[model samples]
Target: MRFATWAGGAGVVSDAGLHPLPSGVSVLDLVCSGLPAALEAGSSALAGPPVPLASVRLLAPLTPPTVRDYVAFEEHVEGVRKSIDGVGGVPPEWYRAPTFYFTNPYAVVGPFDDVPVPPGSERFDFELEVALVVGRDGTSLAPGDVDIFGYTIMNDWSARDLQAREMKVGLGPAKGKDSATTLGPWLVTADELEPYRDADGFLALDLRVSVNDTLVGQDLLSNMGWPFEELVAYASRGTWVRAGDVLGSGTCGNGGCLAELWGRGHDVPPLVPGDVVEMTVEGIGTIRNRVVSGVDLPPVQAARPRPRIRRRDV
Candidate 1:
């Protein structure tokens, strides 16, 4: 049973495919609220209007009541090392356990949406990641407590220039990453992917990405330095993971983002006003977003302050 939240010409709505989700709500509302029954029952009883995929806009699949993206890939860590400071090895802490931080869930968007190249961003890159949707709720549950509702594809679109600037300040990747995050298309439920999540507690799948029909990156899921179970276990320590929260499994080695495999050089052209980036992960669906040169809307810019960090009470 897969679940999704979407928008239509009329307005935003909930939809589970078999049956429409309750009106005026989102997938986050249903999953976090623990109402899988509504999804189960809807599978066979509704002739709801077919929400045209084209007419509707896709918001981030998980409203995430909260969001956490982890840096679990050692290759990406090494890659980030070289991209930002010309360093070339993973830090000793890279193998300790999965470490992560909250990102702005409000910045998420769905597949096929137009991603604006941020102001002065000359080194925009794409990161192919698989993100999990949390379905269980508990205060610091053990490794056994995670009941993931589903998975989706995420493009941690990045601006190498800004990222390099922020990391030097001791604070994590902030404004550099604020506007480039993208996710969506659909959320494939756990039940629907039992075969991929094997007994060994590893998710094995083929992940790939391409730009303009040229395959720029590809990798197998078995290569992950840390599997999903390890990530969930470490991430849940000393903190509660609730329904609707999201856990992103960072970018895999050989994945799209240039910082992961290619170094910071002009060997490749940067994203301009009209480029389409399509990424696919086995089991999880593909996400395609077009890059558009954003219009300089001064009013909208003035109304919003520059992005900044807000520490949580935890």
Candidate 2:
């Protein structure tokens, strides 16, 4: 079943619809793993007020008490390698279990929201990713320890210029990722999306993105280096994954602004103010965010033009 939290009147995303839960409950709550149970229950509950999907502002399904975005896509790894490392290959360690980094939970915004482009960012780009929302709270979970509550499309909006600047310093992806991250439309429960994963255990959703009607990034879900479960186990090795936490499948191969536009031309146009970005991963949903330029506050007057009385004194 599909589950959604949306803002109809206030900032809160009310429980509109979902699948059946373990018990008979209408409102879905964050549990250990995904919201499968809550979704199940919500789906089975008596119909609530019909809040049209179009009218509500969809937030990240889960508040993600915490967030860990993993760089587990081989395509992205290889692409960056070829461009930066000048080799068309991946590092030996990149094939290991899904590895991740903490993304600022506070920086997350809902669907159809305006993502503020960092000031001076000339190469602002987009990443099409799928994020898992942990429903249960646990520590050191074994494989299959947690069940997925659902999946959502994520736009890991990137600042390529800042990224290049920081990577040269060898610090990390900081500054490369800040200011804004987008997720949602709604949380598609596991049951609804189970058919999309192939027998190889890799997801098989059709993921694609476009900027102002121009197709840029594209990929099949079947290509992820590590599945969600492995990432969960690897991530939870020393840390605990609590309910409402988000785990993302890093950028896809051939995905993102840099990889797609690579060699397109030396005069590649960078994202500027007023650009509209859209991402759609099959089964999840579409996320649309507009880029807005950062501006300075009100200008200060120069002492009222040095006071006209100065002319009278002269």
Candidate 3:
């Protein structure tokens, strides 16, 4: 069963219709309630008649309590690093553990919406990724004990120019990433993927991305160097992971932005206003978005060297 939350309330999508969750309750609320029965009930029928999928304005299924995005594919990391610096080697610690950063959850957007290109950014881009929604609170949860409620398509929108400038300072990708993140046509429950679970314990799915209908790249979920479960365990190592938190598997190889593509001599143009990006993850579904222009609040201008530091004494 697939679940989604819109302006009105949360609901499950079945062959019949989009069945609503109990009044005033949301997918976030249901997850936070931490009741297995509540989650189970999402797939069952409801009292009222269902709504047509086309009628509702779907929001990001849940307003995440927090979002932790991890880089799980070595190929993706290597591709980016090689593009930026002409180098290739997995960081020593990457094989030992997963690494991630917290990003703004407030900027999340639904699948069928327009994403604003952050101002002063000409190198805007999209990252094709898979996201896992945590459903239980567990402190230092063992990998075996980790509970993955569902999966969804994630487009971690980026401002490459800003990201490059900030990384030089060794402190932020914050503003570079805060503008928007697109998630979901709907959430596909874990049980729905049971058939595709591989022996190595990773879900195997074909993920492909396109811009303006031209295929850019594709990667299999099994290509991930670090599986999702291990990342969840690392996330819970010393903290409480609550329901409604989103854990992302970072961009798949060849599934990243023009920054890496251009760096490698690919002729792709950077994303701009009027471009449409569509990503399809087998089973989960496709999420498409149109890029639109946006203006920065305080208005900014390119920095100019202040007359060259008038010089010094004899």
Candidate 4:
């Protein structure tokens, strides 16, 4: 079942239309309850009258408890590294394991929401990717043990100029990335994607993105260095990956983002106000968002140098 959260409330999507779940039960609640329970809830809720899908305003499927985005695509990593470092190659550490960084959960936006150009940013960009929602709490899980609730389209919006400057300090994509993240249209249950899994067990869904009606990039979901299960397993290494948490499959190869294309010598213009970004993952669905101007920010003052501390014996 495709689950969604909209102006009306949480509901199940069907050919008939959107069937509202009982009042007070949210998509988050369903995610935390795991697949069996969500299936039961969706089945029971279908008896209610359905609402036209187009009439309702869709929202981000759920407010994730935490969002961990990985760099699982070698092509994207190599291309981005070449652009930033003037060399094309993947780091050795990257091959050892799936690496990820935590992005702000609160920065999430709905499928069709307006994303503002982050304050002090000029090189705004969109990343085409796929994300999975965790269905149960788990830690140190093996790949086969990962419990995923569903999948959705994710746009990891970026401010390239800001990200470039911050990472120089050796520590962030922080403010550059925290500006916004788009997830939704609706979340398709994991079972719905089984038919699309390849012989190696990787999802073979087709991913495409367009900027203002111009096709910018396309890739296969199976291009990742590791599968979603492995990404989740790495994420659960020592910390708990609770239900409602989201794990992104990073950017796809070939042209997942402007940066990747730019690294490959493609001269694409950065995103600007009024530019609409539409991304689609074959089985899951599509999400469209428009860029808008952000609130002007006051200039930040440079930090003062701290006095050197004398070493003392413990």
- Model 2 lDDT per residue over 1-314, tens place: 45555543212123443322233222236344246445444544424344545554666654567778888787787676555435567778877567677778788888788887776676787778888877666678886786666778887888776777677777657767876788786776677788887898888999888888787778887788878888777777887876667888888876465644453223447677888888888877788888888644444334444444635544
What lDDT tens digits, residue by residue, belong to model 3 across residues 133-175? 8978889988899888888999999887788777778876788
Tell how far residue 313 is off in model 1, in angstroms. Answer: 37
Count of backbone collisions within predicted model 4: 0
- Predicted model with the maximum TM-score: 4
**Ranking by TM-score, best first?**
4, 3, 1, 2
Q: Using alpha carbons, what is the TM-score of model 1?
A: 0.85
- Residue lDDT tens for model 4, 236-284: 9998999999999999987889999888899899999999999999999
Best by lDDT: 4
lDDT of 1: 0.72
Report every candidate's CA lDDT.
Answer: 0.72, 0.69, 0.83, 0.93
Q: Is candidate 2 or candidate 4 better by TM-score?
A: 4
Clashing pairs in 4: none
- Candidate 2 lDDT score at position 296: 44
Task: List candidate 2 segments past 4 Å from native.
Answer: 8-28, 32-36, 44-46, 82-88, 263-267, 296-314
- Residue pairs with colliding backbones in model 3 are none
Worst 10 residues of 3 by lDDT: 81-90
Clash totals, every prediction: 0, 22, 0, 0
